[model samples]
Target: MERWQRGDGRLIVATNAFGLGIDAPDVRVESGRGGRDGERSEAIVVMPAGRQEELQKKIARAKARTQPWKIQSRVMRPWETKQVEWEKMERFLSGSRCRRIYLDSEMDDRQDRKRCEVGEERCDVCEKDDAMVEDGEARRAAYVEEQRVIQEQAAQAERERQGPWVDSGIDVPSSSRNIPVPSSEVLVPGSVIVTSPQPFTDQDITSSEEEGRPIPQSQCSSVSFDQGFAADHDPVGESRMFEAQKQQRSQQRWRVEADSQREGHEVWNLETRLDSW
Candidate 1:
């Protein structure tokens, strides 16, 4: 145990790694001393686990010696102590005066004191009650005003759609009968150019001029065999390529089937070996 002075008060703190079993009477000072800020924040006092472990071991050894002894045991388990500490922390944080009053009524064990209120030693919250209530009311009023603005905007949009002129020529029917397009328009293959009013190539000769290919004097009609090769026949060396591709595909399928069967057998053997082990 070591003593230090802070806030003009002497604070005795335990750093001895174990409880010294000190029995000071009239302990006006709080236990867990470096804990003034921590008390306000509801944090735990972090004592090392060395002493707690030793205490548990000693208790276990004693219990082992008296295995058949018949006496009722009374001990505060860790969970019970934690619950008491948590309850104390919750009461300390609660903001309502009514809640604090109820807590005070429940835990005031000393009959010497009538109540926990201090005219001369007030807790921090007792001095600031009025401001908290005012802030809460202000926030509620602002929320109600924001909701009113959204409702007004929605109503205005509904009225605009109900007005007249929903049938005039300017209104434009939703059906295709009101839409206008020239009858000559039609889709032609290999080019997006419009061919209705005149031949599409009449509009431009620059593409042909750049390529230096004379536009074949408009052949009124003949399937141009020179344009592309016939699909049924292959040229010279290309005829044998198809046979090689077919053989390769057949070999790949055989390898895949054999590997799958080998994997299945290995899995079955592994399961059987594990069962024997």
Candidate 2:
């Protein structure tokens, strides 16, 4: 046992009578550790003839509070109370349906239990059940994965339809119609575009010019304010808004830039440019 624990021994050839039956924590860890590299592997527990009967006899004797011939080691405990852990182990070893179902039923009082399904790695009983299954396991796995992805997409769409705050799991009010999009999109040179954030687009400059109404990157304001609106705050007495090229939004100090040119970056930001006579 020490050699096995220390990686010295490669194989363990013995009955798993104590661990698999009564000791829940000790069972399956070593066997399951084989497929750690994400490859297909199996952990099989072999039961010899008359082994279960022997285990049953021992369990019965223990349940009856009969004294053993010799004192048990520290690992095996004396009957502290009527604990049903031993019985659970017995049922687990002898379960017919899904192994996970049995385990979950024990762990949580779960009535709506699920099996291994088509895509998952089957337990021993499940493998035996589908010994002559017509459908390929690989196909089943793919179908299961696809279903999961579809579910995630659906969840995201639901959140988006509700609101941005819904996706953030906050109770603050926000517009579902005007969800945020990227602002730092590149445009062609000589495209004197307006970045009024209502709706974002990538329309050709020439096409827009020919259309008579040059469509801007009209992504109207999408905000996630703790205690504020989309537009800036304005005071009643002081009117600093629209003083120059810059405009001070209502109820806010931050200045909205009409246009600013950086090195190798041309930005044309305005609401709409209608030639008024």
Candidate 3:
């Protein structure tokens, strides 16, 4: 045993002779017929299926030797210990309860009760009916697909809204609508061109010269200025009528302020007269 513990011998083979008095902490693995230290370890026992009858006969013989005789006492002690050890090994291999709990109970440790109190870390039998593992995986898959669909829909909407601009082959600036274009050329369909009635082309200039009629500059200038101002201030106070209306509103505001001041002065005069009385 000392030689095995010191690594001088890697293996030890004996028939029930090397079971006791061996306390090597570094001995991690043991393969034999029974349990060793009451710590976390694995024990593998290989026995023939036909040996059940032989094991039963041995147990019966050991029970019969329990009679109170001087030699029987000596023989019964080993048999009782072996019987108890065999029964514990049988329970360990039964697979009905948690292996850790069974091992702790067999070794008379109270740690099994602590494990029961927590009730989280359980054996295969306890976790066999758990459905959350599958349900969580399904929910994660559905969420991923939902996010993918939302992203696809947003991308499709963006593509549809920008389709016209892309098809026209023009790098449309954000301020394109405010840019002035030539009257002869149309940049977009359905756009209304509010040009002057008398076109200012070279043909019109030659026709006016030949007809000996000069174009009225004042009327043309006023119309062009009004059109440009209307474009700048569309939908709010852009007409000549709106300018007159704004003037009237300013006069009304002045009248209201003067009336309020006059009433305040009258109240002050009345308060002075009451104090004198």
Clashing pairs in 1: none
TM-score of 3: 0.28
Q: Candidate 2's residue-wise lDDT over 1-277, tens digit each?
A: 6676666866777764523533322334445343435566566667887776776676566678856566446455556323557666665576445776765676557768667666567777687777746357767888999999999999889666644432243232334324456465457589866453344445565678888984554333444332343533334312332332122122123322322233214322222223331
What TM-score number comes out for model 1?
0.26
lDDT of 1 by residue, 1-277 (tens): 3332223444445564443554443231333332233333222335455644554455457557955756444787888789867655444344323333534444554334333355333334554654577788899888888888778877677446533332231232233232234445566797766643333375356777778987553322222223442223224434455455455557657989999999999999999999999
What is the per-residue lDDT of model 3 for residues 59-88, given as tens digits with 9 covering 90 to 100? 567568966746546555877899778776
Give the whole-model CA lDDT for all candidates, comma-separated.
Answer: 0.49, 0.54, 0.58
Off by over 4 Å in 3: 1-6, 15-17, 28-87, 94-96, 111-277
Candidates ranked by TM-score, best first? 3, 2, 1
C-alpha RMSD between model 3 and the true structure = 24.1
Off by over 4 Å in 2: 1-7, 12-37, 50-83, 104-111, 132-277
